[model samples]
Target: MDVSMARILVLTALAFAISGWAAEEKPMLFSPVSEEPEWRLLDSGQGRFTRQEFENRLGKIFDPTGAMQPYLLFDDGGVTLFRDKARTRPLYRLTFVPEGGAGEVNPPLLGGGDPARPLAGKVICLDPGHIGGDWADIEERTFRIGNDAPVVEGELNLRTSRRLAQTLEASGAKVVWTHDGFEPTTTLRPADLYPEAISYLLQGSLGARLPKYSANRLIRWNAELLFYRSAEIQARARRVNEELRPDLTLCIHYNAAPWPGGRVRLTSANGLVVFAHGSYTAEELAFDDQKFHLLRKLLENSTPVELGVGQAIGEQFQKQWGFRPENYEGSGYSHASGAGPYVWYRNLIANRMFDGPVVFVEGPYMNDRNIYPWIQAGEYEGVRVFAGKSRGNLFREYANQVAAGVIDYFRRQAESSATFTNYSP
Candidate 1:
């Protein structure tokens, strides 16, 4: 067979492999397109915590719903974190220190930078979410009203990141980008992902969604989702974790609400919410990758830093934009961190995959009647009047608040002699 024909045959076999019909089962059991985790990497966390600390942290920040209980076996000596409820696969053995005993913890946000340049030695990685340019339509992050310029979320994110990076670098911080331009970080196109998408679909059932769309259309839709969401973010995560390895990573995004009647018009639902990577759902905790990341983030001691920075940005948002907190009261995937209106804890692909502290900021709702024109106005040179106050264009304002919050947090760190603390009885 020719190379093209052989490649098709391989993919056809792979589809069966994904469906579990093939003799050799794929190694990845959870989180499609994810590699099977090397469970040994969590070895360092042994004896790094106390039983109280472990339970407290989980109750407070990571798993509030007791989703992790099944996977953890607690005893006087330690807690054995398992890969499954059956406990056949052991992931880590964490020993508890005695009460008031010294548990090894890397203090978060030690105040050491030059007072003026609070971020002097810090490395910040900025991720402008989604691929715009020609990829905008495919990403589904672009929308428009009757005869108006398209409001593309990726465009807004890139603009905001550029301005934020400028401010951060001026404060003596080095700023890196996951991708500076619109091109995708992953080489895999939608066509290349068809087999995996097919496999993903087949997992649901042989009768999975051929009703809504034909087999080809359903496969195409799944291929696009995997391409944009799973594959795309995974590519960015590889860069953030492996290559950049910065002190902190910021994922910038613009929020949107469903337009009334599903029309492409504006609404009055603008608000703000920032995420600091916790709150793994019960369903999510069952996945191996989710469990691995939950512990990894906990072990890194990023909570205080994430909360501090998140609160700072939130303050800036209130002061500058005067928007109310974006409510996630009914949203099962997220919960308030008790830090402030703007800060919430939620597990997300970028935040979960990145190694260090991750601050995911979702700015003004795109479909807000009040903000739609501001978006249509695009990035302009001077302030524009919205709600009877002069405001920088949406891009600059978004960037400024984010940068200010970051700067404020670091400056507070620089002045204080104390390590950030989130532990409370």
Candidate 2:
């Protein structure tokens, strides 16, 4: 068989394997064999999904003959079964929710509900790129930038996602972040701090001054490490989205690529390139298109960053941040397509695993050395100025514009769907 045909067959088999598992048996529920597991309730004010309720549902779905095991009920309503002592193999996840239940609730618009009535619920999963320990692992810390240079993309992505999460939460969205820091924590660590620390230590040494070569090399090494880590982080984010079943999944990252003359350039300009899963069902695709248009309007109104700025920022960031844009074959925004590399092959995984609309945002690149201090300091206000003098009040301005756009999108969708539902020839 031809190489392409063989690859196609393998993919076909994998799909079958996944679907077969899903169809063979209902998700099983095993009682805590050891000690009674503590159940945590995720109450988002809009509604609540408790572990008990999830287990109860699972019990109903599981086949009577099936064995039970420890399982995880993710905040976004995804349930995973752990059969073996090890949690390596992920059993089937519960994808569908019965109508009119908490799981089926939609996000409410601002001021659309009475104080007494619960607001609409929406789940937003943020995947920050890179793990904290990525630099330490040489094997996992290497990745290509643009086409050649190696750089670390994970660290920058994680930091930006952390900031975005804070902004989204403050805007009344239920935000769940995957891989907080190197370890599992609520706080996000600065991506550039580790390299900066090395630089600091090197600067303190007299030998470092004699040869700038070693210092420059170290910087370049760290950047490559960041890219490898970012890839892992993106994978984890996809897993989390699968388990959580959020309303939207946003993978946040900074872009990097080589300059025309093989030199590096830094930039402060903000660009928003939204990505949707290309293999989505028609219904999901329609929803994504609506979201893409709305996001475009929101971003265009907020910053000078345009749709095709992914490559520009990617190249600029590599020169500035020492990393490269993520290399996903399916990324919609490729140079060949003039769309830029916003979409990725794994994005299909995220979309398939997730039950709702999903998007990836390659926010402003962090290579703009002029704004590095502000970003490192968590001074978003200063960062906004660095983006543009006209871009005042970073979070507030961003929140207002995005919120307005999202609200408008949903309202239109709901209205159109309602009209269609009521229509009769």
Candidate 3:
């Protein structure tokens, strides 16, 4: 063979050899493809998973065009994945011990595993309030008490969380949740604020390290896994974003008040209102402002209530519902102007501690007699009707308006963060 031909053949063989070696060196947990497309479950925790299983999972998760799938996976421990643009970002890594196993299974490092690693991409944390049991306890069993009111708040929160998660996931965003369905509380109180509380919760031992506190000490204290045993939730959220620092953190929740006769309303007010914590700093205030802008827009679109009409609605509820709107102060009907436990809790944790933009939606009211029935029925579509009849749905046209606002915020963040080269179409 000619000298040039021989050299070209040798170079081609060397390239193939390097490619083979690189493939062999890569961790087995990650797909062979570097494009990192969205993956779907083929068998779903079924039979022995081999290379074929992996391929099938990939096929199911992705389309024939080989696009990344938007989905999340969580075992008993904390393990999450966000598939997009042919790459998977690890949200959290867990060491799982199989039943009767001698040792644990350490998730192989694929994208990244360090807890302090920057988030690979954007993340959405959905905090679904209450639980299914909360609904049964109130609606079915008729167990009414302090703080434990009805499960309506929890149910609505969970439903909306699920919907939002599904929507965001489809859009290629990593999503995690604080609670799925009333799991055992594993949160711990912080040692600094309540050393005794933390010690007591951990049985005199530090089960987990706490996140560093910034200006919001109450947020830090409340963030403890012990106070409400929400530490595990916080840890999971932190772990997933460790390597792939999320671009945003969203806490989904419904509003509630103590009054019995108020109707639904929206709020434009913004500030830090921590439930576990008492106050906030300038930075926290800025974050809350961004979140308020996002949430106010979202609620205006989702809820039938009209913007700048809370006072009008309050007046109408008193006249028509015959119950004082003031009485419904804590039942998810009042705006930010009114004080309630739910408001305090939502304002504190969601707005203060999260580094990214955060916001909470007071889904719907459960205390107002006219609104409570629809909520119990899980009939959000009926909300538009109620809003229209009551002049609250006049804001429906603003749905696109609010959605546009969120899109603009995200576009700005993307431009600044450079996290995604392009927004998902």
Candidate 4:
């Protein structure tokens, strides 16, 4: 057999084995076995949110009546999240809910398209993580000096996304963006949804950032507005599911460590961490739609491909930039899919809510002594040499690597499915 042909056969067999394994397994539960900072299991003693906390937060985004009371219920003797509702089926059990709402775009079958433009006819969505620009501070995605220009993550990621879009479009792939610019896609800003949004902050880990209980209402409220992270992300999820139905979604972000005192400072950490949807917390599992989403994720056999794309991107990053995969000692960094060291299975909002496979790319730590300067260097035209290599501007370099990964992944998929005109497997 030909060399590529043999590789294709091996990959196909592996995919089949994976799909079969997914079919055979029972619904797995999330139980954090370690106290590592990354080992997070919702309400599993170390989770970021408790049952009450989750209920309140979920309510702010999904329910309001207190009617859906404890919309989420934990069996650890915690109270229910929403009120009892009349239903055809029970609310909290592990039953599969058929996917509804907007239609989804699955991976396109290859073969009839131009081999040069391997991504022809594919719809890809590039979601630059936060609502940036003027809203950067509001989104908590900016690092800055007192009065000088801020290093806005949203702006940088958007630039990278636009560059990636150009590459994809040049290769005959149509790309959609979750947000065109800094402005959010949500119907209402956090200011409009103030109290509820504030309630969430005051109740969760971010609460520490709030003023003391005795602080004046106006002062506390202003502080709460700074942490509108969840609401904004949920808005993006709504857009991903309802509007931009792409074959795949890439959530772009520049990584950063927990800034001490919520202030950005120079840090030694610098690495790439990519997430491709696994690690479903028990809180997420309790929801019918989430359960269905998890089931579909496993059955679609997309995780392997997601990992493949992630690995491809990681390799390109390493080759072009001196970036390395993030490896930490915890379940946060665990659940490796065997496709690559950088790829992980984190149950983030984008990973859980997007209709199709989501590859969350957490780029290099923005505060790294070596990396921070590049972020501040802004954009430039044509090629520039950095770290002993010639490449496009920083954003372009990032975009090129990601675009190369997507192209490579589809090329392999196309070659593997050479026998069929519309084979998704």
Cα displacement (Å) at residue 398, model 2: 5.6
TM-score for candidate 2: 0.39
* Position 404, candidate 4: lDDT: 94
lDDT of 4 by residue, 1-425 (tens): 24553454456447656767352232222211101111112222222233443343333322222323434444553333221233333323321212332222243332345456778988889989887877776566778855546788888899889989999999888898888787877665545654443333332422236444433343335433533454556667677777777888888999877776765577778788788777554444444445444434443435555777887787777776757777643543235555667776666766765666778899877778667767667787777665565656778778888899889877777666665556452
Off by over 4 Å in 3: 1-121, 130-150, 185-244, 259-347, 379-384, 387-405, 412-425
What is the descending TM-score order? 1, 4, 2, 3
TM-score of every model versus the real structure: 0.90, 0.39, 0.36, 0.67
Residues 299-375 of candidate 1: C-alpha lDDT, one tens digit per residue: 77788889999999999999988799977776977889988998999988888888888999999988898888888
| Candidate 2 local lDDT, 1-425, one digit each (tens) | 24553454456457657866352243221110111111221112123333444444223222111223333334455445343335554533443343345442222222332222211365667665445354424434334335543444566556556556665565456887666666532122334434433333332321223323354444444434333433344345445645676655555554443343645554444334444433222222122222232222221121111222223333333443333344533432222213344323122333333334444455444444443433344424533454334343333333333333333343444455545555443
Write candidate 3's Cα lDDT for 57-93 as tens digits.
2332112223222333445542243322222544223
| Local distance difference test values of all predictions, in order | 0.82, 0.39, 0.35, 0.61
Question: How do these models rank on lDDT, best leading?
Answer: 1, 4, 2, 3
Model 1 — which ten-residue stretch has the worst lDDT? 202-211
Q: Could you tell me how far off, in angstroms, the CA of residue 336 lies in candidate 2 after the best superposition?
A: 11
RMSD of candidate 4 to the truth, in angstroms, is: 17.5
Candidate 4, residue 217: Cα displacement in angstroms equals 6.4
Which parts of model 2 are misplaced by more than 4 Å? Answer: 1-119, 132-163, 166-172, 184-242, 259-271, 279-355, 368-377, 380-384, 393-405, 415-421
lDDT head-to-head 1 vs 3, winner: 1
Per candidate, the number of residue pairs that clash is: 1, 23, 48, 10
Q: Quote the positional error of residue 310 for candidate 1 in Å.
A: 0.4
